[model samples]
Target: MSGGAQADTAGRHGFTPRARLGLTLIAGGAVANIYYNQPLLGLLVGEFGERAALWVPTASLVGYGLGILGLVPLGDTLSRRSLIIGQTLGLAVALLAAALSPNLACLALSSLVIGILASAAQQAVPFAAELAPDATRGSVVGQVMTGLLTGILLARTASGLVGAQYGWRAVFFAAAVVALGMTGIAAATLPKIPQTRPLRYRALMLSILHLVRSQPVLRRSSLSQGLLFASFNAFWATLALLVEAPPFNLTAAGAGMFGVIGVAGAFVAPLSGRFTDRRGPRPMVVAGALFVVAAFAVLWAGGAWSLIAVGLGVLLIDIGLNAALIANQTRVYALVPSARGRINTVLFTVMFVFGAFGAFAGSQAFLMAGWSGVCAVGILLAGAGFLVNVLEPRGA
Candidate 1:
């Protein structure tokens, strides 16, 4: 059944199959907005000059981080259905603005707005958690995330293809059309959920800090994910540079194809969720960290010399991160039901900050020592994550 047919009763009866699918689609589509500019940077630079390459993608990413911190909290304060539909409508305008931009300033500003609205995707996540039955919540989150991760992994490739054929403007123009369709779909599919917490905006923001102090699981989960993200970003920040030089001699497109290799990780997410449901999130978290640690080991062992080793390491690291993410998120959401939105805010904010540090650290490491430096960075971060899981106080 389509979402329009199901929306009327979905809230009372809980989420429907089509509604879940809608959430997954919304998550993917909305998040894809923040990434569309990456592959179009070359084209942007051609028209707007070198600064476009630096500022365009940077503006979008910064906007996404800010949106997560600012807009995502509204999920707990407002009707999520209304919020999503409104954001999609706004995203449409932003994308259009991007497509028609005559100067870098206008384009950068539009990109910022696009990134801010893109947090609509993150809203779909906790919404899934809110509606899901406890037994299957992990599985649901995993499935939705599979869509999200795929959109992220594929956005660059899609943008490259569109930009190469039709021009960079066409990519944003097409995205605008998609956003309008998403707006309509959201109105049809999203259940009209009443606000659970009635706190004002200021109070709502402050309460996130309160939740942080109050929930140990939230702290640990956020920290573990942060550490793991540091590892994930370390690999990604340096992958293109590593492969494009000497021994590997891969072109940019070839390096980009590694993103496709990471898709295997997304497919494993649902299985991780199922396992977390049965065995509890803790073991999965531990196992995830271990997998990452082992991935770094494989990379350190031979990844620099052998493309096969690098490919295998990519698969393991992605699987580890996604698996840990599903488990960590499941545990965090289960913690204060009324505060899941704020909890998510804290989680993602920490992860983003740590990811930035990882990128910086990995770059420095690669410059100083080469591939081994990158591998060491991954090991240290993943190992720290493993330690966090193991050293938990045994029932806090």
Candidate 2:
């Protein structure tokens, strides 16, 4: 089926404010599962010791990347409502397992399942796209993404506070409860949309490549976001470690305080979306990347000397990344309206694969070169993204 026909089949049914809020909640709640471990790494290190703790965050993120590649494509073939609900339920189960884990190995394994099921967030993003009017689509996407980003930052704060007060396992238990509650909300509120044209499962998978080959905007937007995401992940993956070490000497809970500061930046997503609706996404992409470059400069200069500077850098980084993300997503969703699910899958899969790399690189960079090294890596990645934004064909 052509993208246009598929979009036409998805008849517009007044996406009211209530539905938008519901989608924001669902997306936020689902994506939060994949990030709950970042700030808790220090606590995990205390509980399981460093050797085992070091790999837990990476394991969950790698699992999320795998899920995006493997399960998200199914959105184009399956019932999205059923798929989203099933994944949310699975996430609750995984979180419960993590909460009850007897050892780091068990918890790490459970984290992987948590990550895989968390691809439910991917389905929700495109589903929101399908429901909105064409004129306001970018704004709707931005609002949904705002929820997703807010969830990510809040997960850290919740985990840090919960882990500090009740122990690391309590964080997972809390997450499990949240997931179960979100499942009920999703089941009650989400509308049923009929499936698109049925292709054989193998053919459905291969069409991802066909979409990539045919769409220049998807390729450029995906690559641009991937590079910027690498930098974003690089900072976040090591944030707990950096703050927990020498001059800062903060606990796991303390590391999580930064997440609260990051939340302030998330307000930009909706605004960026509105702006993109008026100004176009490319300009925002360029401006956002420049913000990231400035953020890294702050980190490099203030790594050891000023907590205030580092905090400002964190805020800037979040603002920059969220802006670029909203812009890129706006571009991709417009490219092939009917294929939003597949387009999001391809875009995010590429972005998160690089995210996994960024996480790995952040850890290694911290071990070898310290905070200065980490900032350097972030600067290079964001700079590369800016160059791509400038050089890519404007028509694309």
lDDT of 2 by residue, 16-109 (tens): 6766787899899998988888767777887798965667887788788778887877877777778888999889999999989889889889
Candidate 2 displacement at residue 184 in angstroms = 1.6
The C-alpha RMSD of each candidate to the native structure, in angstroms, is 3.5, 2.6
Candidate 1 backbone collisions, by pair: none
Candidates in order have lDDT scores of: 0.90, 0.84
Candidate 1 displacement at residue 384 in angstroms: 0.0
TM-score of 2: 0.90
Best by lDDT: 1
Q: What's the distance in Å from true for residue 381, model 1?
A: 0.5
lDDT of 1 by residue, 1-396 (tens): 222223223334768887789888999899999999988888899999999998899999999999899989888777778888999999999999999999999999999999999999999998888777778889999999998999899899999999999999999999999999989888887777666447789998999989999898999999999999999999999999888997999999899999999989888889999999998999999999999999999999998888998899999999999999999999998887767778889999999999999999999999999999999999999999999999998984
Model 2 clash pairs are none
Model 2: residues with Cα > 4 Å off, grouped in runs: 1-11, 39-51, 103-105, 238-247, 360-372
